[model samples]
Structure formats: C-alpha cells, structure tokens
Target: MASERIDLLIIGAGPAGMSAAVEARRHGLEVLVLDEQPSPGGQIYRNIRESDPQRLAILGDDYSAGRRLADEFIASGARYVPGAAVWQVGEQCQVHYLLEGRSVVVQARRLLIATGAFERPMPIPGWTLPGVMSAGAGQILLKSAALLPAGPVVLAGCGPLLYLLAVQYLKAGIQLSALVDTAEHRDILQAWRHIPKALLGWRDLLKGLSLLAKLRLAKLPHYRGARALRIEGAECAEAFCFSSGGKVHRLPTNLVLLHQGVVPNTQISWSLRMRHQWSDAQLCWRADRDQWGETSLAGVFIAGDGGAIGGALAAREQGRLVALAVASQLQRLDGARRDHLAREPQGALARCLAARPLIDALYRPQAENRIPHNEVIVCRCEEVTAGQVRADVRFGCLGPSQAKTFNRCGMGPCQGRLCGLSVTEVIAEQRQVSPSVVGYYRVRPPLKPITLAQLASQSNHDLSPETP
Candidate 1:
C-alpha cells in the first residue's frame, strides 16, 4: 500500500477544505486534500458547464468563487486527489483510504474533516417513485450539468432552500406546479429569537432577504400550512396529496423536489470516534469543535457543516479560522497571529448565524410520521420500506441503532449516510419522544478502510530496523 506523511491532511475538497488549505499554505504548512468526486466543488453551488463565464453568471457567484478557490488549491502545491472515497478515519494519526482500487495509508501531523452535509428526507407514499428527490440533489444536477427534469416540478418541504429552489426554477424558466410545506404561525414565532443573531451583519441578512424577495416576485404556487401526506402514482410520480386543517389538497405534478432540511455530514468524523452534538435547529448531528476547530481527538480538526450547519458562508469563515490555528500549532504561525487572522471572518459568520435565527427553528424534527399509508422507501441503500421498519418496531426494537440491528434499514453501502435523518424521525415517532430526546448517533471507529499489510506493518515498525 502507498503511504505518505504531510503536515495536514484535509478529508474533503469542498468550501471548508479549500478555504483551509489556501490559508494554511499561505502560513507555510504542507496540505493534502482528498475528495470522492472527480472535481472540487461539493453539492451546493457545484460548478455548471457553460461555454461562457457570462452564462455561468445565470446561477450566481457562489460557483464562481468556489471555482477560483478550487483552482488555487490545485496550483498552490497542496496535494489534491479526486476520485478517492475516504471510508475510515481514526485518532491514531493514520488514515486508511482507497485510491484507484488500492488501499493506502496517510500519516498526518494533523487531520481536518470538512466532509460537508446531505439533505434530510421526509417520507411519503409516492416518494419511492422515480421522480421524487431531495431538493439539493435536483439543484446539483442542474447546477453541475445544466440539466432539468421533464414536466412540472413541485418544490415542497421547508427552509431557505425551498424558496431558493423556487427561485432557481423561475430563473431556469421551468414552471413549477406548486411549492408546498407545513408552516404554522408558530414556526415564524419560534424563529423570532434568532433574528437578532442574524441581524448583526447587514450584508448577510440583506443577501438572504434578497432571495426571499425573489421568491415573492416569482409568484409560484406556495403553501404555508400545506403538508404532503402521500405521492400517488402507479410507476412514477403523477401527483401528490397533502392536508391542512382537515382540508385535503392534491397537487398535480410529475416531479417532487423535496427535503426537510440539511444535516451535518458526520459519518467520516464519527468513524474516528469524535463526539457529536445534536443541533436542534439542524435536526441532525454534527461533530464538536473548539473555537480553533480541534475535535476531541488531538491532531483531528473539523470545520464547516461538519461542525455546525452554518451554511456556505459559515463554512468558509471556519476554514480561515482552522487554517490559522493549524499553522500556529505546527509553528508556522503564532497564537496572536492566528487570533488576528480569524477575528474578522469569525465575527461575520456569527453575525450571519444570528441574522437568520429562524432558519434553525424551522428545521426541528417532525412529531408525527409525516408519511403516507402506502410504502415509501426511507433507506434506499437497504431497500427498506416504511412498513418493514414499523414491523421491526412492533417487535419491540426502538432507536435507530437498535432498529438498524432489527430491520437493517441504515446498514448498507452508504451506511446511514443517506437515510439517517428519516430513520431518526421513524425512531422518534415509534418511541414517542422528541427527536432531541432520542439523541443523535454515535460513530464507531475505523472510520476509513485499511489493508492487512498496512495494519501489520504499522504495528511492527519498531521491530524492523530497515522499515524506515
């Protein structure tokens, strides 16, 4: 197996990792970044193909800036490896990973995980149909490939993303059948306390408000109290049925772009045995980090959504902060210099988080199943149906881990990476506890895969005089 060492090993190539690498290299640290995709951009604001840069301006500048940083990371002498799926990570200062179908070990003085997040799914009857997808997934296809699904699309669910997609559809010149969600007056009321935090930064607040204004102008079919109960179709999605105050609503559409919200991508970090905190606002779990981005394990750091759902802006700021801390620890920078480098962006991210306090309040776990009577696939990896999960619970297994042991819902190639959020809701509903009370998940170690030779070689290093 190939083996190498670096001053820092960054386990993602998205905004957080890119940002961290750029700043760290400036302060004189050797950085290596690994990503599963062929290129650098992550799900949000991924690069779109266009003959002209002016054409890319159609989506927004988020992609433009990411492109610049990605290019810089490639040019800055920091090692960049794409098409590498990093499965296991640990606190023992070694990484077991796969590259071109072979296992390799990377020994790092320090490690930073910026492995981003995935969309949260809310299951319903026809959701298993060919057309239903997380809103983020839909946008990734459009943003990355400039492709749009056929026929009318329904943008349902909640959060800023719902409206963001509605606006994107309007810009892409696609007519939306209906934009639906269940938002009570209490949803906004619960969010009010968060406004002051968000209002601290005018630019960030203004940007979010601008997106809302665009949604208002688009004049698409939007429902506040509407809740999708089921999707009805024989082979594919033809229409969806929803309810509000005893009144049933059936929105006719061919595609359903749905997502409850986004949760932190914690699988890689969890596999390293990092402590995870359940963010009630995010309705998902994230790894814990100190102000400087250090995890519970020494030499392992985290930034971006892996630490918290601070969005792209927060993720970017955290990158700068982590870079400074890491450089200082490795002696390329100093404490005062590190603090100075982090001050401005850290304050700005905090202001941004405070400005949209309501965003977090909007994503709390669902109290009811929010699913339909028919079978809706929750764990796509295991092909586990909602009925099967309920059957397992009926047999007395509760909680996601236990439920996984019973029905094998979250155990698959993706592990629980894709369906964890949905399964959490199912577990909470069965246990009749707030999803918060159900608590977040715990990641077992050996976060990435390792080879037998690498393991044996590592253990017997001192036994062989010629090994080094």
Candidate 2:
C-alpha cells in the first residue's frame, strides 16, 4: 500500500497515547494509534486485556487501572494498529513504520509521540550474563506469562519498581534470598527536603511507604546503603556481591534483578531534531516543549514518560492536555471549550508531577554506578566498554557524537537507546565536565532497524500535503 494520511497520528498506545486518542475521538478528529506491543497497554500495564485473573490480583490496582482506560480508548473509535514498529518520522508529520514484515507510511497534521520509557541503564560486571536481568524485565515476565525465577532470587537497586516487584514476588509466594538497595543514606536525608512539597501528592508518597512496609514485613534480608555491586557466575549468574555499611556481603542466588529507575525513551524525539535539555534532578535528557506538549517541531508533541519521567497518572493527564491542544489547533474545539475541558486534567497533571522531585531525589543512581567501572560494558549493542569510551575521550573525542566515530558506541541496532545516557555520563566524567556540556547522541532515522527490503517496499510518492 502507498502512504496513508490522517488528521492526527499517535505513536504509542500506552496510558498517554490511549488518553489522547480518547479525547481526539470526542472532538471527531480523524485519528490513528500505532504501537509495537501486541496489545494496547504499554509495558506498565502490559497484557491487561488477556491477563490471568490470578495474575491480575497479584499485580495489584495500578496494573488493573489500565483495563478501563484501554477499554475507553477502544470504544472511542480511533483506528489502532498493534505490533507496529515505527522506524522513521520525516518532515510534515510523515511517519514510516514496519508492521508484520511490511513497511507502512502515514502522514498527519500533528504527531503525538508517547513512546514511554525504559529501565535506567544499569551496567555492572556480569550484567550480560544469563539470569542477570532488569527488575522491569522480570515484572514483564510475571505480567505476561506468570513466570517467576526458578531458583532463589536477589533484588538489587532502588526505586518503586524494585520494591513493587519484590512485593509482587512475595504475593506470588516466591521466596527471595535478599534485597540490596543502592540508595545511600544521604539520599533519604536529601529526599526530606522535598517532603513538604511532596505532601501535595500525599497518596503517591503513601503508596511508596506502603510498598516499603510490605517488604519489611516479609523480613527479606534487606541491605540498605548497598554499593559496589558485582554479579559473579561462570556461564550464568550464581551469586550477587555488594558492600553495605562498611561491610562486604555476597549472597548465593540464581536470578539477580537489577533496577535504578527509568528515563524517557528519546529516540523518536532526538531523530526529529527536537531540542533537548538535561534534567539535573532526573539525571537524563528531556525534550524541550511548550505549555501544551508541542516540541521544537511545530506539529509534533510529546507526552507521558517519553517527554519526561512522570508516571502513568501524569501520562494520562498530559495526554488529555495534549489532545486539547491538538483539538484547538485543528479548530475542532473553540478556545472557551478547550479551556473548559482542559481545566481539570491540567490540575491533575500538576499534582501528579509534584511528587517527581522527591521520588528522583530518593532514588537517584550514584555517580559511580551511573558510569560503572572502566572494564564494564557500556554499550550492549556494540559491546563497547567504558574503558574504550574513556580511551576515545583521552584521544580528544570530547562528545558522544565524536566518541561514536571513535568507538562505535551508539552506532548499533539499538541506535543508542540503551547506551546514550551512559556514554554521555562517561564522556563528561573523563573530560571533567557536566553532562549538559557533553550532550547526547545525535539520533537519525530509520529510528529502528529495518531491512533493505522493508525500505524498498516503501512508496516513492510523497504523502499528501497538510490540511490548510
């Protein structure tokens, strides 16, 4: 098929994407949503439609809330395509994607990228080994397949997901060997500074406290202030090692789940040549946008964790807020009507965003952990090591773009998705500069990998001109 066109095209079906679609439908705007997942929910609420009842009960209310939003999105009548891998996004809202071995293109007046986020880069010794996986990856397995690790499991790292997964494992009646937290004592102390403002979103704070209470009641061998982690194994993970409170501890375990938190998935935004700024507190690059989520590119907007690391609640609110902007831009909603509709969601978004500073402060990954040891692999795609990148820096490769030429750090199948932030941090540390000065990788399309056949299959003709 040749390129298709629509009024509004959305690039994810997570909370943000779904919420935007639902609002766009009410305004009667022609819309389409594309997602890589086999189903509607993004990773956070994956497989909610087909989730087992037992598993749903085990996963808790946050997981269950997605089903209602997804149902509303389905009923809203916006066209939805699942299992679609978006590869390139071009001028005037032209998006190229691959679906089931076929390349497709669509043009729209506006594009909303709700690509969401991924687990923060957690590179350490033996991380590539089997049985050493991210806490988010483990949660997906449990969510999608009800699978749990066979042998004793050790949970390491900080953030709500780590504790949430730990709580879920306990609910599933799985025994854990230990829980090693990388959050330093000073993090908790610094986090207190935000507590006054964080109380504005008291429910979220209470939720974190509740997760902590559950983990404590389970009496798991909890190690606070843990650092210097090393995963040891011959062919697979066998033991987890870290230092805690001036003592070194090693626990025998088969599965080692690691997590630090999450950061925006910025491949699409960066490829669009949108401006980004370093978020000091969140410790990552975020898209520069206006009040209504519009990026530096006029018609392209970003919401959800893709724009910044606000959780699902914030994503949903921001989605609605963006849809209002789109509706007004399309002249489907008059100014008064748009303002009336946006009022509640705008406040909701602010409240949801209020807790982020405290959360980020409480769970910020240590600088040492962020860069890792010189020997540790930095780029999983090209197997580029921290040492190689530092060597590149020593040789006058001052930025990630230059370092990429020297070490091929970000030039791989994943296209710097997994290693961009880590590489930036490593380069900055070596050069004795701030990450903001070092800058992120320069991403280009095809944003994802596509075969030559897929490229050849794309239509030669241009998409129709934008609606005037």
Candidate 3:
C-alpha cells in the first residue's frame, strides 16, 4: 500500500475544518480537507455562490467570506478534496476515504476532526413522508441551493434555527403555512439564569429575535407550546396533524420541517476508539476533548460541533485552537501561542453553553411513551417501530441493549441516536430500570455507514513480510 503523510488532515470542510486548514497552512503545515458537499461552508455558513448575482449581493460580504477563504486556501496549495466521504479513522492515524466510489488510505501526522453536526430526528407520527425534513434541510435548500418547496410548508420546532429557516423560506418567495414553537416557556425562563454568563454580546439573541420578527411579519401563523400529532400521507405528505396550547388540531400543509436541535458528529472520533460521553445538554454522545481540542488519544484532536455544538463562530475559534495545538505538536509554536489561540474559543464556548439552547436541550422530544402512535418510522435505516420494540419488550426482552440483540431495534446505521432515546422508554418500562440506567447500552465504532473496501484496506496492512 502506498502512503501519503500530511501535517494536518481535516476530516471536514465546514467552517471549523476550513478555518483549521487555513490556520495550519499559514503556520507552514501541509493541510488537506475533505467534505461530503461541493462547497466548504458547513451547516451554519452555507457556501454562497453567484447563481443569482442579486442574491449574492443581498447576502452581503459577511456571508461571502466562506468562498473567499476556500478560494484562498485552494490557491495556497491547500488540497480541498470535496465530495469525499471519510469512512474510517484508524488507531495509527490512517484515514480511509471513499472518493468517487474508490477507497483510499492516507496517514496524517496529526488529525483534526471537525465533522460538524446533524439535526436530531425528533420523530412523531408520519415524519417519514416524502415532504418531511429537518429545519436545517429547509435552510440548506434556500441558503445553499436556492430551492424551495412547491406547497404550503409548516415549520415546527423550537430554537432560533426554526425561525432563521422560516425567514429564509419567506425570502426565497416561498410561503410557510404556519410556524410552530414547541419550546417550553418555563425552560426559556429557566434559561434566563445563564444570561449573566452569556453577556458577551446580545447578537445571538438579537439574531433570534430578528428571525422571529421576519416570520411574524411575513403573515404566517405562529404557534408556541405546539406539538405535532401526526402527518398524513401515502406517497407524499398530504397534511400534518398536531396540537398547541391544549388544543388538538390538524393543519393542512404539504411539507413539514422538523427539528429538535442538533447533535455532534462523533462517527469518526468513535471509530478511532476515542472516548465519548452523553451530553445531557445536547442529548447525544459527543467526543470528549480538552480546551485545545485534543481527544482521549494522542496525535488526534476534535474541534467544532464534532466535540460540542457551539455553532459556526465557536467552530471557527475551535478550529484555530486545534490548529495551534497541532502546530505545537509539530514543534512550530510554543505553549503561549496555543493558549492565545484558545482564549477566544473558550469564551465562545462559554457563551453558547450559557445561551437558551442548553435549557432547550433538557427536553429533546424523546421519552418513554413519547413515541406517537402512527405510521412514521423512528429508525429510518432499519424501518423499526415503537410497536415492534414494544412487542420485543412484551416478549420478555430485558432492556434496550437486549432488545437491540433480539430485534435489531437500535442497531441501524445511525447507531440508535435517532431511536435510542425512544427505545429507552420501552427498555425502562420492560426492565423497570431508570431510563438513564438503560441510558445507551454500549456504543461501538463505525457509527455511520462504511464501505467494505474501506474496512478491508485498514485491516489488510502488510509490512512486506519483514526478515524473510
């Protein structure tokens, strides 16, 4: 097998990875970045294009920086390998990536994982219909591709993201039938306690308020304390059934945008045998990392949402932090330089933690019996169900771990993130243990789908039959 060594191999090309790649290259390191998408901006900073020069002009220079940075890095000899899906990371810093359907392996002196995040699937009845997607999906359509649905869409979820997406839809000449906020009032009130720590700036809060006003001024129906009852559709989403303010009702809309916040992307970190833990704040497993983005293992680091959910600005700072640490490891910088890079990241992380989202993460739409009684699938990859797991419990399965063994309920491609919390209910009910006790079962590696070729490459290492 051939080998290529880069000083830094960033597994993602999002805001965090982009920043790290730029910083590492500036500090005289050979940097390579790969992304699943065509562009470099992660979820938060959607890579802007000149598809519509007017739209580009409207988005302003602030949003246009991603393209500039991506271009500059590419021009500066930073290899930006887009549309490559990184499948695995080995203990020896070997990365298996499948690009254009061919598996390749490369070793990195140091690895910085900034794999970013994905929307937490908060399942209710009929979420599997054709028109249903995450709020982030809707935002990506407008912000990245300038696409919009052809029918009246319903935006349902909490947090600033919901509103931000709704406004984007409205801006793109699409109309939202209604905007539903499932965030609890007490939770929002309780989040106020963290305001002192979050006093760095009110810009985040102001952005939230701006999005809210944009949705309201667009004359869309807005609902707080709302809940989705069910979505009715056969081939596509015909309409949505939900409740709000103690009133059960049905709203007719062709599309439903769903979100329950986000969880970090720890698939690479986990597959590399890095240590991780459940973040009650985000309600998903996140890689454990230090202030400098160093993971449990040496010569490997985690930055951005792959470690925690601090959004785009925080991710940029984290990328710099990781770059500084990687620079130190390469003997190009000192301890003071590393600390200087981290000062901003730490402050940003503290602010995001003290923001309203932490309080919102306390209740993430999954509890025992919270599964709606209807046609939506929880584990989309497996097509399992609440009824199926409930039946497994009825047939004498002890807990979620056992239920997984018995019925493959939580053993899908997502590794139970989508349905684990839901399955915990059945486990606790059947085993009579605390839901937290049945908390997650043992989490394993390759959390996402990987190719056989990629796995084989790592396991097939041969060192030339030495001494023969």
Name the runs in model 3 displaced over 4 angstroms. 1-4, 49-51, 57-62, 344-376, 391-401, 410-417, 424-436, 439-468
lDDT of 3 by residue, 1-468 (tens): 333447888888777898888888878887778788877677666665333665554444446666775665556566777787776678767776766666666777888888898877677877777888888887677677667778888887766667666766676677678887776676667667656655554676666667667776888888777755577889988887777788887788878998767778665775665677755556566777887888899889888888888777778778887888998889888888767766776777666555546335433454411454434466666888777777777798766678788778767776876776667655565567666566554556454466676566553222232231
Clashing pairs in 2: none
TM-score for predicted model 3 compared with the true structure:
0.86
Deviation of model 3 at 441, angstroms: 6.7
Q: Name the Cα RMSD for model 3.
A: 4.9
The whole-model lDDT of each prediction reads 0.72, 0.90, 0.71
Worst 10 residues of 2 by lDDT: 459-468
Name the lDDT of candidate 1.
Answer: 0.72
Error (Å) of candidate 1 at residue 202 is: 3.7
Candidate 3: residue 70 Cα off by (Å): 3.0
Q: Model 2: per-residue lDDT, tens digit, 1-468?
A: 333446789999999999999998989887889999999989998999999889998899999999999999988878888998999998589888898787887778899999999998888888988999999999999988889877799999999999999999999899999989988779989999998889988989999999999999999889998988999999999999999989999899879999999999999988888889999899999999897899999999999999999999999998998999999999999999999999999999889988889999999998777898999998998999999999999889989999999989989898888889999999999999999999988899888788999888875323444332
- Ranking, TM-score, top scorer first: 2, 1, 3
Provide the lDDT at 438 for model 3. 60
Q: Report the C-alpha lDDT of model 1 over 361-415, residue by residue, as the tens digit.
A: 7544354434323277878778787677677877886677877888787777667
Assess every candidate by TM-score.
0.88, 0.97, 0.86
